[model samples]
Target chain A: MTMYVVGHKIPDSDSICGAIALAYLKNQIDEPAIASRLGELSPETAFILDKFGFEAPEFKESYAGENVYIVDHSELTQAPDDIAQATIVGIVDHHKLGDLTTSTPLECWIRPVGCSNTIIKMMYDFHNVEIPKDIAGIMMCAILSDTVIFKSPTCTTADIKCVEALAEIAGIEDYKALGMEMFKVKSAVEGTPVRDLVMRDFKDFNMNGNKVGIGQLEVIDLAVFDDIKAELAADIAAMKNEGERHTMMLLLTDIMKEGSEVLVISEDDTLIERAYGKAPTDGKVWLDGVLSRKKQVVPPLQDAFA
Target chain B: MTMYVVGHKIPDSDSICGAIALAYLKNQIDEPAIASRLGELSPETAFILDKFGFEAPEFKESYAGENVYIVDHSELTQAPDDIAQATIVGIVDHHKLGDLTTSTPLECWIRPVGCSNTIIKMMYDFHNVEIPKDIAGIMMCAILSDTVIFKSPTCTTADIKCVEALAEIAGIEDYKALGMEMFKVKSAVEGTPVRDLVMRDFKDFNMNGNKVGIGQLEVIDLAVFDDIKAELAADIAAMKNEGERHTMMLLLTDIMKEGSEVLVISEDDTLIERAYGKAPTDGKVWLDGVLSRKKQVVPPLQDAFA
Candidate 1:
């Protein structure tokens, strides 16, 4: 049986890299598996794929199979449109679960870790499957990017431990230096079109029966968004017009400050204040210590809507 | 930390006994666990508990704890009402998953087996924990009850194997005779009130946003339901009046004939014909070779609603 192993839409380094590692391990363990991505990879993810000897996974909109293994996501909204029709035989994810149900009982391996690749490394060790250098390099890049070089609040001891083991396996001496090299790509949005810049790290969600879209642009310099704020706002409005978005936002995250200047757009302006308990100044709100959207943004927004 | 291990709300033999067996196994592995039940036990389950010299578990309305280990069933409708508030630490179940989500990832062990007790028995063997004779007796009763003495279509070789091994452990020389003794309890529905008879082995479900209920009464005599068909239909209508039920059915399953005479009551009689491909003759229809509600009933009914 051919099982399509894929991650959630809006592929980050962790989602794309974790899909490849799980597909590799599943094949090595005698299951016919192919790695796939649900959406286009971000620039940092593309850079990591080139740094390692791995090609970007083939993109597909939806999957229909007797057996499909979902990797790195458990949300029904984030998965492919036809995911509810497929028999989801297995899931390997690191995020909180959402409205996903299966008619048949299946294997679900979800861990509360910083990065999905950290859990994949543990799975490889559990199955006694050796991690090759190229795969290990991508796995390390995933951990580095998702955990923000061990500086993100999401980073855990498991992520750090896996990085140590995988760094040795990939023959990388200085992980800190390598992490800095990846972060440099996150700042390469200087002349990029406003639409592509905002869409790079975008994620769509269904909350309170409303489609909510949020994008993050991590940069060392926060002044870039200030220069292009009008263009960014216009792009957000255009994206919202595509249909069914109750609210759309672009998080101009100052990486070094460990915070985000969340630009807001919605039918009601007070929802931003209601969600975070703070009013926005000029259609933007400062969210301190908000690094990850899965942990930080969605929960309070859901509460506000509730 | 004490965790209350429980099954679904209308506790059957498998749900009750599997909770006991899982609680025992978890305690054997140094996890502090207590056997519990969500609702009242059925007569067959009560008989099994009395025969095995085990006290019925304490009943509770909702669990709000640091950790709770769920066993037997999956699905928010089947679980305790406040299950969403609890931090689910581990889940060992057999049925299809429903709209249940955990904020943090934990150990979820689900399999598509005839009985949840079979999964618990395998877990016992996996952990090298010897099964006690009384626990094995309850586990055997659970498997025998859920699998209809290895006759249900849901039964697999693994369930049969567990039954054989557990039979040896529980000192059961004739499993078929024991199963006959249990089915005798189901046949004793003479003095029971119509509402109680209809509600005895009932389970409520949400099929495509419509509330549906299916109850079963396994008996040697089909003439019992033929005597009071109108009373059963009236009780079903009264249950529907309680709100949120699109359809209600009671399966008059003849154990010897190995088929069910389904008595249905609904707002729309055409949906029943569309679901099972036969119009009910005065609110009663025949379903040949249908033994398991989970495997046989829910899937097609869900499809019809969709």
Candidate 2:
């Protein structure tokens, strides 16, 4: 059977590119695997794919009775609707271990690095498989995007080394310039719908039985969102009600400023205060030096929920 | 802070040996690490350690406030009492994914292979760290015990390759003979307390909120258990009540015969029937060609419970 490699819903650059690169590597060594996506790609990922001359993976949601390999995320909330029916053959992720259980032993290659692509790069070296140039290019871009050009706290030496090796294979001299270009494309939200912008990098978390939604919009400048901040807040409030979530938060992250301006809508706004020790004024607060959600945001929020 | 490496409770050969091997590997690369155990060693594991000229790992139950790297298993039911308070730094296991969540990105190397030692061998190869003679010996024995001398269904090509490499490093030309000798020591259950025998290789599972316990005793002959089967059942019944377990099962495996005589004590015995398509006769069932509890037993039972 052909195994389908996919990423979490609201596919980020790391998720989409990691799926493609991992599928390529799996085909080189072991099984016949194809890249797939659970949802539409973010503009950043789409731009990276086009820049690397690769097409978007086949969009798929239901994976019933299929052999699946997940990447980037392990939480069941981020998985496809019929993930319970699919045989999860393996997972390659760089996140906190979530409440996902399996009946059989699986191939898990989780690491503390910044991006799933870094671990996939390790897998390639482990199998002695040569990564194709385009795959390496996208994978390098994934690491850069995930690590925020090595500025995010989640970035590790492994991510940096993997990106350097991948850049060598990709024959890119100035990868940081490419990363800035990608983020520029990511920041082009002038005419994009608020729903699309929010859902671009959105994720749902099951925090102590409460559904919590978090979305990040990483841009070079936070001023891009000044005009539409209220609309974004109203949209997330509507999303909280529509998705029946206990809390919905949008992080307007200025990559240059190295912090997040968080807008939260919750049953009790004090949950955010309890998490970060900073009370929100008018449902907004500045979280200084909070770049990586997995590191800086979700853990404290999960602890507060616990 | 010093990190501790541990394995599942009622430590089997793979669990004990894997903890020692992984702690050694971690110390070679990263931090100061020590091997610890949640429970006493089984006779087979004791024999292997003695033959390898190694001491048993330090027995420490609670890992509160300690950084831990778990080996061989991932289930919270099999972990230490205060595992929730400990930081799970990583896991190297060969079991189904369990409901253990970490708050941070972790180093996980879980594989579908039969033995954790196989994955540890790969990890050593990944890091280019050479395994010591005694560690290789114990690791080889762990693979032999977990794979039932290559007879188990869970045994994979990776496991066979790992054992061969470890055997070469340990300078053991007749590892299979050593495996049989270890099994001989394992079969010496006579004069041992029934509770001790039952608890030698027992593990608890949270089967859909119900605590289910399973124990396995592999021997050369099933007749050794014939006189004590009723006593074993009574002790497991007492264990079920004391531990508030919904079900308890003991697999008296005849390794030479390649089968198991399962003695089950459950709230509803039909769960076994639903799992295996074979109803028990007087709370006992003879399952032919059932050597691996992880491969042929636990998965089906988990599914039935689900």
**Quick one: how many clashes does candidate 2 have?**
0
Docking class of 1: acceptable
Q: Report the lDDT of model 2 for residue A62.
A: 90
Task: List, residue by residue over A1-306, the lDDT tens digit for candidate 2.
Answer: 899999998889898999999999888876999999988888888889998899999999899999999999888988888989988999999999987788888999999999999999999988999998999999999999999999999999999999999999999999999999999998899999999989988889988889999999999999999899999999999999999999999999999999999999999878998999999998899999999888999999989998
CA lDDT for candidate 1: 0.83
- The 10-residue segment of model 2 chain A with minimum total lDDT is A38-47
DockQ, computed on Cα atoms, for candidate 1: 0.45
Q: lDDT of all predictions, in order shown?
A: 0.83, 0.92
- Tens digits of per-residue lDDT, candidate 1, B1-306, equal 888888888888887898889988999999888888888888888889999999998888778654777777667888888887787877777777777776555666666788889988977976799999999999998898888888888898989999899999989999888988998886887778888788777888888888998988888778877778788888888888786699998888887788888888888878877888888988889999888888887778888888
Q: Measured against the native two-chain assembly using Cα atoms, what DockQ does each of the candidate structures obtain, in the order listed?
A: 0.45, 0.91
Alpha-carbon RMSD, candidate 2? 1.3
Off by over 4 Å in 2: none
TM-scores for every predicted model: 0.81, 0.98
lDDT by residue (B1-306, candidate 2, tens digit) is 789999988888888999999999989997789999988888888888899888999999989999999998888888888999999999999898988889888989999999999999999999999999999999999999999999999999998999999999999999999999989999999999999999888888888788999999999999999899999989988999999999999999999999999999899878999999999997899999999999999989989998
